[model samples]
Each structure stands twice: as structure tokens, then as C-alpha cells.
Target: MTVRTDLLIVGAGPTGLTLGIDLARRGVDALVVERADGLFPGSRGKGIQPRTMEVFDDLGVLDAIRAAGGSYPVGMIWQDGKRVGEHRMFDPAEVTEDSPHAEPWMVPQWRTQEILFGRLEELGGQVAFGREVVGLTQDEDGVTVRFPAGESVRARYVVAADGGRSAVRRAVGIGMTGETVDPSPMLVADVRIAGLDRDNWHIFPPHGEGDGFLAVCPLAGTEDFQVVARFPEGASVDVSLEGIRKVVAARSHLAPDDVTEVRWASGFRPRAALADRFRDGRVFLAGDAAHVHSPAGGQGLNTSVQDAYNLGWKLGAVLRDGAAAGLLDTYEEERRHVAADMLGLSTSVHRGEVRRGEATCQLGLGYRESSLTKETRATPGAVRAGDRAPDGNLDGVRLFDAFRGPHWTVVAVGVEAPVVPEAVRVVRGRALESYGCGVFLVRPDGYVGWAGDQTAGGLGYLGRFGGR
Candidate 1:
């Protein structure tokens, strides 16, 4: 069967599903296609950062996400079968009004995908499973893709959320440049253990020369623990149930019988790579397809979800809101830089050059350097153009609630807002501590697109995105 959609998402992971939800809520005709018939089942990429939490809140999935996950547990270091001490994975930070989610949350990647898939279905969206793209052709107007199972699709825009080895990316001929963060191959598996306590993430350091460390983190909201172990470069590693048992027995004091079962297993080499470009013709790359990160800082899935969040609105604007197509160009300009920065951060965390701290949370990321950001005010306040619009309660209204939905927002903080079209949401309040006293325009993605001392220049920024 031949299907038609406004946006064709080539993956069913967090990236494609998030984009599906966003575009579906925006009233865009979109479809998510997955090569696999069911959601990915594993605990890989289990860390959801603070910024990603905010994004989920806006997407109406926060309640489900919070209910499905828990905060990261403290690390428990062990040596010679004895508990040495307790270790903190992240520095403590108080959750403030402006930044509500202060630390990373631990949810299995499979659970995250399940929650997102549910949200997508709740939005009346459809995902085509077992539909693998074998060919892609693009013209001046739209993209046409074909699969081997007698299925084809025509989409106005095609998003390659397919993953690191993206079929669509390779079909489109986009090049990637990157380096191997670690030469040592790693084995990650979800296993059931009998003797381990779920209260802490158990860590077992290398005992002898050429040995690698092992970490068993209890999966929040689940009975399983994710086991991660590294082997010397080129050493043979096993992922079988008995193999995992042997590793646990050798690395820790636990006997092979302690490993109850192995649910899923996989082996990989850590890599950090980014696509040479984010956009080509009518095709765009998002998530792991665009930027592959070492699983060090838990940025891979979070960054990919944010990429969909960033592009969803722009595509909706141009397709449904009558905005100029030039708005689409900024997607690459803004997201590419962010992806590059995140690639470096992930590599740093992998090498132990940087700790998983404030940067890894991703709440401070912004697009100040993008051409779309306009800081007209001569003197900037606490908030500036291209900064994340901090959340706060002011004048009996929640700023995030005002900025919710698929609409732009013009916030008048101790200033008068200019006359705006009904398409733009108007929020007025007293001086906010987080945003300060200025006229701020928040994009559909929740970042400040424009800021000024008064309403005179605020309207201009809205016009660029078809808000005025």
C-alpha cells in the first residue's frame, strides 16, 4: 500500500516518536515508520537529563515519565568483595522554580520508548511497523521512499531518526566524521541478579592488570539491573547468560549462580560522531542519526528527543502556519552546533575529563548564536535572546502552562506587550526573578526567541515566525 504523510519519520525510537507526537498535536499529518514490529527492549540509554524532563513536561508525557522512572541511585563502590564506600555520581543541586528538574532521572530506554509510543497513539497518530525503507528519492517539493515489502510513502519532509547506522542517511549520501572514544569493546546487558541490593548502583573496579571495571545499576521502576562491563581492547567478550554469570563471578565476589537470568544483551565500541550536515533537500537528520554520542553522559537519547522538539515546530510553522520556508533552514544552523557541542561533552565524560554535572543536565543549552535569535535590548537582563525561558509562577499563572501547546508566546514581564495575532499566546505578569523584567518571546520549543526592554521590538521577532 502507498501512504501519504506530511512528515515521514523513519524510526520508532524516542526521536521519531517524540516528533510524531509533536507534529500530531500541531495538526500536522505525520507518520512514524519502524523496521521492527515492536518497541526496543533494553535498559541502554537509561538516563534522562533535566532539560529532557522539561521537554517531556511540555509534550504532556511528564506524568507518565515520572511515574515510570526514578532519580539516579548513589553509587556503591566495592573492592575484594567488601563495600568500600559510597560514591555520588552527580553533584547535588537544589531544584529551583526556574529549573524544576535538577538531576538526571533513571528510566529504562525501553520504558521511555513505550511511554512515547503511548503518547503518540493517544494523539491519534499511527506508526507503521516492519516497514523498512530500501530507497529514497527527493525532488524540489517532497520526498518519496520505498520499501521491499511492497510499501511506499510520499512525504513533504522525511526525517531520518533511524539511528547511528541510518538507512535513510546512507541512502541520502550524508557523510559523518567522528572518532572512537574508547577502543575497548563493552558489553551491556539487562540481567536479573539474586544477591544484589537495588538501593545502590554497585560498582566493581578492575582487580588486576588489563581488567576492566564492572557496574551494575538497578533499573528504576523495574526489577532488573543493567550490567555494564568493559574488556581489554580486542579481548573476546561474551554476552550469553552463562558468560554474564562468569563475568559477575570473576569481577565481583558473587558466584555464577547469583545471575538469575539474562533478559537482553549487546556489545559495542564507544563512538562519538556527527553527520557532516543536518539537512539535505527535503530530508533532515535527527537523534542518533545526526549525532552519535558515547553513552557516557546519557546525552544520546535526550539530545535526540530535543532535536525532534526543535524541528517539529518549524516544520509545522512552514507547512501549517504559513511561515516562510526559510524558517526551515534554521533547523540545521541551530541544531548542528548543539549536536557538535554535545558530542564533545559526551566524549569528555567518557574519558573522565569531565564529571556528569550541570552541563550534562542540558538545562542551560540555548540558541543565542542562531540567526533567529534577536537581542534588541541594548542592555541585557538575566534572560536574553537565545536562552532557555526559565519557568516560574507569576501573577497567578504558570509560565510553562502559558507556553504550552503548539503556539508561540509573547511574555510581558514588567512591560507592555505589543498587539499580536491570535496565533501567538500573550502572557503578562510582574517582574520575574528568572526571566527578569523585559518583553520576551518564547518559541514553540520553549526557548526565548526575542527579548527587549519594551514591546516595540518584540513584535518584529514574532513576524519572522509568522506570529505577528
Candidate 2:
């Protein structure tokens, strides 16, 4: 059986699902396929960063996610059974007042997906489970996709979100170039504790004969916590409850019997790798399909969500109104930098004794190299025209209305302001001092297109992105 659609997305994970929802909301029909029968129920990738929260807010799913999960204000780093340092997450609510997004929230990946999948359904899109894309062929006009169920789909564009071992990427002959970390098998378990400490994330650095470290983080709405033990090379210990109990007892004074119940457990290795290219003609890749890195910073899920968000609006614009195909190229140019930077940072976090900082994981990224960036001469750390525009209020208007589509937002401050046409949503406020003023153009995906003083070629900057 052969089907047709405007876009065919391979994989039904968070990235693919979010892409489908974004396209559907824009009235651009998309078909998503997944090999799994249903959502993966696991404790994988539980931290949702601020940028991701803003993306979710734009998609109108933030409220659902918040309702599903709560927040933790602090993340701690420990060494030798003592607290070394602590970093508090920038409050998403406070940050969003001046940002495109409010603040980052902590939630399980499954809960985040549940809300996103619900939103996709509300947008009249559905995932075709138990279907996998086995092969793909793309030309200038479109892509022809073959599935394992003896089915085929012809789409104007194809997205590979099938994960690190992506079949679509292989079929298209894209090389995923990078180094894999040595297989240091780590034991991960989710369990309930009767008398163990539960105040904050617990870290036990290598002590005595143990090889690596043990980390404990709280699981919201439950009395249990997620425990991660990085075993030293050649360390022999089973991942069973008795094994965990013995290890905990050996490292800390905690007893094995203190662990009342074990909810889940697994052992896996982490790696850092990225695709050499993100696009090949009509086919593109997103999420883990393009890059894979250590979970040390909890950035895998957040980065993947951002990847889909960036591609969603661009692809929707192209499919619906014939927006420039050049926009699609920016995905690779922009996200690959992010992935490379992530790989570097994760490598550091993995080896060094220092705990990763939230700023390194969240705030420091900027898409200045993109053609969409306007103010080129700005210094580093300065809010340039093309960076991720910070969130703040303009007059009384909020920057992003998650329930509705984002508009070309113009932030005009100062006594002498350029007259922006009615086609743009202009907000006049003094809060622009922290972010910027003159004129700021925001892409539909909530990225800054251009920002500069009113006299800094605001008109030219606006014209670049189709603002009249």
C-alpha cells in the first residue's frame, strides 16, 4: 500500500511527534511512522530545559506538561561524600517575562511526550505505530519512502528522527561521524527507599575500593528516586536489588534493606557522535537521528526537542506556501554547531570532576551564524540581532502565546522609535533595556531573526524575513 502526504516523518519519539503537531497546527498535513507499538515508558531523559519549555509553550503544551510534572529548584554536585557546589536553575517563569520562554521545568520524558502526543491528536494528526521506514529515495521534487510492513509513502519531504541507529540516514548514505566513549557500563535504577536520604540529589564520589560514583535524584510524585551508579572499568557487580544494596552499603552507610522496592533498572553505555550532514536533498534528520551524546548534562532530550521545533515551522512554511527551500538548509548549519558544542561539553562533564553548569547547557547557545541573524558586529555575550532572543514583556503583551501562532514581534523602545507597519505586532515597553530595542524580529519558531537600534537598518532587517 502506498500513501501520500506533504511530509513523512520517521520515528514517533518526542522529536517526530512534536514535528507532526507543529505541522498539523499550521494546517500542513504530515504522516509519522514508528516501529514501536506505543510510547516508551522509561525514566530516560527526565530534565526539561528552559528553551524546551518555551518551545512547548509556543506549541500550547506547556500547561499540560506542568500539570503532569512539578519543578525542582536546585541541582547539586558532590565529591567525597560532601557538597562541592550547587546551581539553582533560572526560574522559567521569571525568565520568560523577558525571554521568548519563561523557565525550564523538570519532567519525565514520558510525561512530556504524553502532553505532546495529546496536542498532536488535537491537531488532527496521529502516529502510525508498528510501522518502520526501511528505505528511502529522494529527488528534487520529493521523497519516496519504503516501510517494513510492505507499505510506501511519497512525501514532499522526509525527516529521519529514528534515533542514533537511524535506518533512514544509512539508506541515504549520510555518515554519522564522531567518537564513541569507551563502554563504561553504568547501572541505572528507579526504586523506593524507606530510610535513605531524600532531600536533594545525592552524589557519592569514588570512595574506598569503588571505581566510579553514585548519584541519586528525586522522582516527582513518588517516594522513589532514580539511582545511577557509574561502575569502574572491570568492576563486577550485578544490577539486581541485592547487588545495588551491597554497593550502596559498601560505598555509603545505607543498608540494602532500606531499599523497600525497586521499580526499574538497566545498564547501558554512553557515546558522543553526530551526523556529518543533517540534510540530503529532500530528506532531513533531527534529534538523535543526527546526533547522540552523553546524558551527563541531561541535554539529549532537550536538544532533540529544539531540533524538531526549529525544523517544524520552516518545513511547514515551505510545504504550505512555498517558502524558500533555503530555510531548510539552516537546520544543519545551526543544529550541527549545537550538537558539536554539546559533544565537547558533554565530554568535559563526563571526565572532569566538576558538575555541569546550567548556563553551559541552557543559556550560552546563539545562532549568530545563521543568515537569519541580523546584528553581526555585536560582541560575545551581547544580545545580538540573530541570537536566541530573550523573553520579556512588551507593554502588556506576552511575546509567545502558546495557544496561538507566534507573530513577527517588534520590540520598539526609546523616545524615537521607527514606525513598524500594521503587519507586525509591535509592543512598546521599557523592559526592552535588558533584551534589546529599536526593532526585534522573531521567527515563527520563536528564534530572533534580527535585533538592533531603531536606526540600525530595522527596515532592512525586517524586509529580510518577509516583513513589509
Give each model's whole-structure lDDT.
0.92, 0.73
Mind giving the per-residue lDDT tens digits that candidate 1 earns over 1-468?
878888899999999999999999989999999999889999899999999999999999999999999988899999998999999999788899888899999999999999999999999998989999999999998999999977899999999999999999999999999999999999999999989899999999999999999999999999999999999999877999999999999999899999999999999999999999999999999999999999999999999999999999999988888889999999999999999999999999999999999999998899999999989888898889999998998788888888878998888888877789898888898778877788888999999998888888677667767672
Off by more than 4 A, model 1 = none
Task: Give TM per candidate.
Answer: 0.98, 0.86
- As a whole number from 0 to 100, the lDDT of residue 367 in candidate 1 is 95
Determine the backbone clash count of candidate 2. 13
Over the stretch 1-468, how does candidate 2's per-residue lDDT look in tens digits?
Answer: 889999999988888998988888878879988888987666677777777777777788877877776666365666544578874433224433555433445676666777788899988999999887777787878899987767899999999999999999999999987775646778778877765455667766676664777777777645668888878776654778888887776665467787777777777777889898999998899999998978766778888888888888778656765557787888888888887887777666776644545554465577877866776334422466666666655676655541236346665555255676565666666745566445566677666677666546776766544452
Worst 10 residues of 1 by lDDT: 459-468
Best by lDDT: 1
Best by TM-score: 1
